[model samples]
Target: MMLTSAAQAIGLFIATNIDDIIVLSLFFARGAGRPGTTSRILAGQYLGFAGILAAAVLVSLGAGAFLPEAAIPYFGLIPLVLGLWAAWQAWRDDDDDDDDAKVAGKAVAVWTVAAVTFANGGDNIGVYVPVFLNVGPAATAAYCVVFLVLVAALVVAARFVATRPGIDEVLERWEHILFPVVLIGLGLVILYSGGAFGL
Candidate 1:
């Protein structure tokens, strides 16, 4: 049972965080050539992930006790709305200049990254709640620890990838379009998995 729980946790963590690599890579690329920026991005990622985990635990506990299983999935709507908003912003900023992009890049802060991470992870809660409910406290603790380690490793890998010479050019060229498209796709997947569209 312990092994099974651990495996499940690892799988869940990977599944939920795969997209984080892309997001983190973008952040790392933006922070490149700036001293102390990578550290700030890493810190923000950790902070954001912590928020997501905490929310999952709280919602899992609360919803397990009070909310119906069917209704719990509707939380996916949070990400859906956020994604739509992001897409709209991206569209509206289609004519943005390099100067604006530079300004936006300069404005990247730890808290800002944390907020983006947390908002981007809205779909995680929909998947985590049920998983958390099925596991024991000990297993949950193990899962959290493993998730933390994996998230750190992910940040490192993303940073490395982002710093690669050719990678930055590709990311920079399409990031505006790619980011919003990814968000929108993620939202739709969450809505479908959560059965939100059924109603």
Candidate 2:
């Protein structure tokens, strides 16, 4: 059962972080010309993800003391709202070249990347909270271990993909549209699976 739970946690971590590949790829591409930037990006990603994990664990443990399970799932709204907001921003900036300037003008700071990562992981928190709540302490610890290791793997994969030729062009062209749509879809999945809609 412990192994099974750990496997399930690994699967969940991958599912929630699939989009990180794209986001991290973009960050890497932006920093491709800079030295030592990859390390910063990696650090930022880890910090952001750790923050999300910590938040989920704290909330799940705290709320479990008093909140009903049904009420807990409503946390899915966080990602849903963030998704809608991202979609709106994409629409507003559909014709703008500001994204290029934003990427080029500044060195991507660790904290900036961290903030983006955390903000983008609203869905992760929503999904993780319930999973953590349902598991035993040992299982939870196993999940955390699995998540940390996989997250490192995720960063390496994103970096490789980002550095590849031709991929950056495609990502740059479609990112604005793709990112928000994925977020919205992820949000819906979380809401539905969490029974937030009572459906």
Candidate 3:
């Protein structure tokens, strides 16, 4: 029974965090070799996921969700605005500097990645709220522990993938184009999934 609960928690965490791993990979790809960047990304991921779980636990504790469904989609604006800003910066600074310097722009912020992770977690809240409600407190605690452990593992795995030779080279080469497009595309996807634009 304990193993079953643990398995359920693992599945839930994995389902909600696949995109997070991708986002982390993007961050790692962009921030590779930069001092302090990895720590910032890892911290941001934890902080952001903590926020997601906190929101879920609090909302579930309230015995219901407080945020209206429509408002959930509006959360996409966070990444949307960040992406546009990144795009503008990239456009403005098409310089003669090396790729490392070029890609090093402002992605090192812990809060920035945290915000992106949280923004990306709107769906996570939706998914977790119901599970938290159904599974009771002990199970929820177990899930949270499993989720946090998996977070570290996920970060390591993503970083490893991003830093791999061929993969790292390609990611480094295309980070400028890839970065903003990914964030914007993620935002649009979030919005679209929520029917935010009626499309």
Candidate 4:
């Protein structure tokens, strides 16, 4: 059961971090095989994700203590609505996250990367809070471990993607459609189960 829950946690991590992959790819491209860039970005990503997780856990703790069980599921709407909006924007060729990521510009440092990671993750906090609340302590612990491990995997994947030319066209063509679908699926599951995979 614990192993199953740990495996299921990957979906939550992916759902919450839909845009981060593209952003990380761009940053990796900016690195252009520069020294220390990869290390800095990895540190920043971990630091930023840690911040998000910490904040979500705290908020979940408070909400779990005070909120009724039935109400907690409604928080799934956070991801659902964001997914819809992202889909709409992507459909219209108007995803501005690329623009936002570009503002990170030529300067790539740990703090800069961390700031971008945290700022971009703001919306994820809403989705995470309720998921954490309903997942129970044991499952949440498993999720944290799983999620932290996946962060490194995501970074490596993004860096690999950066090395590939014309990947943007592929990403542009399907990234939004794919990830938002997952987000929407995850949201519905949370709404239905009040946790992931029935916890």
Candidate 5:
């Protein structure tokens, strides 16, 4: 039962945010050749994700404890709005261009990427909160561990792929094809799970 519940939570998480993970991996892939920097940034991101998930799970569990039953539905709406907003933003800005250039130095851009990572991950918290509420404490830790493992794997894979001679060129060329699809797909999943359309 514990394994089943953890699997369910993991499924929901991946269904809702796998695209973001992919894009984040790709973004970090730009720094791939530099193992030290890439690893540091990836570590920071994983830490941030773990922290947020822990806080969100605690908050949700607490809210479920104290809040009136009627208010729970409203909590679900947070992800709805976030998902729609993410979709809209993706629709609006299909371009992958960024204002910030990659720093040539080895300094960890923890704050900058962390800010973006947090914002990018905000909607996911709302989605995961509901799923987390259904799991036990032990399952929660298991879920967190599995998620961290998947993320670490993605980072390593992206770094490895980026080192290939022509892969970056291919990825860069296909950003237009990839970004919108991922954003829209993730957004729709979150939107549906959040019951944004009232279905």
Candidate 6:
């Protein structure tokens, strides 16, 4: 049971994430491909995710609460829309540099990224609910630890690829493909949980 729950946690986490490469590329583009800035952004992203994990733990422990059971279906609806929107953004993107321009013109600070990342992850809290409630505390802790390590590794890899001279262009050209795949998977999960397939 623990093994299956941990695997489910890891799989769901990976399947639902699109911000990984998006944020990594944004930092690299803005930081002039510097490793330090990429790392800082990566750190910030992980910190944001950590905050979500802590919140989930509290929710699971009942120190905090989730939306009412009656509201869960609607909460589930949000990620479906968000996923489709992200996919559309990926498909319509003209220039990767536009993100940098938006960031600079808007003067979006680092803390803003942290806050947005955290908020963006809110829909993902659903992924932890079943595992936390069913798998027991040890399994939950293991799931969280494994998720943290995987996210760290992914961030490091994204930073490395973003810093590479030619890879940035390749990633930029192909992100439309990758982003939609992730988004679609997230959407499907939400739909399934909402009883679209009677699961």
Each model's lDDT? 0.71, 0.72, 0.84, 0.67, 0.55, 0.60
CA lDDT of 52 in candidate 6?
69
| Backbone Cα, N, C clashes tallied per candidate | 0, 0, 0, 0, 0, 0
Question: Could you tell me the lDDT of residue 66 within candidate 3?
Answer: 68
Q: What ranking of all candidate models by lDDT puts the best one first?
A: 3, 2, 1, 4, 6, 5
Estimate the overall C-alpha local distance difference test score of candidate 2.
0.72
**Candidate 4 C-alpha error for residue 185, in Å:** 25
* Worst lDDT 10-window in candidate 1: 99-108
* Candidates 2 and 3, the one with greater TM-score: 3
Per-residue lDDT of model 5, residues 1-199, tens digit only: 7667667756865675555556555455434344466767677667656655765676667854543333333343433343355456545654654533322222445543444445456566666676666766777777777777776665566556654578766655554444345444544554454465474
Task: Give the winner by TM-score: 2 or 5.
Answer: 2
Name the candidate that leads on lDDT: 3
User: Which pairs clash (backbone N, Cα, C closer than 3 Å) in model 1?
Assistant: none
**lDDT string, candidate 2, 1-199, tens digits:** 8789878987898888887887677666556566787889889889988987877787777854454456545655654675687679667765775655545522557875676567667567768887887886778888999898888899999988976779866665665665556656755765677677785
Off by over 4 Å in 4: 63-107, 166-199
Residue 187 alpha-carbon offset, candidate 5, angstroms: 12
Q: Is candidate 1 or candidate 5 better by lDDT?
A: 1
Tell me the tens digit of each residue's lDDT in model 6 across 69-160. 33333433444564476567655654564665433221224553454455556656666766688878898898888888877776776667
The candidate that wins on TM-score is 3
For each candidate, C-alpha RMSD in Å?
A: 4.1, 5.1, 1.9, 9.1, 7.1, 6.8
TM-score of each: 0.69, 0.66, 0.92, 0.61, 0.56, 0.58
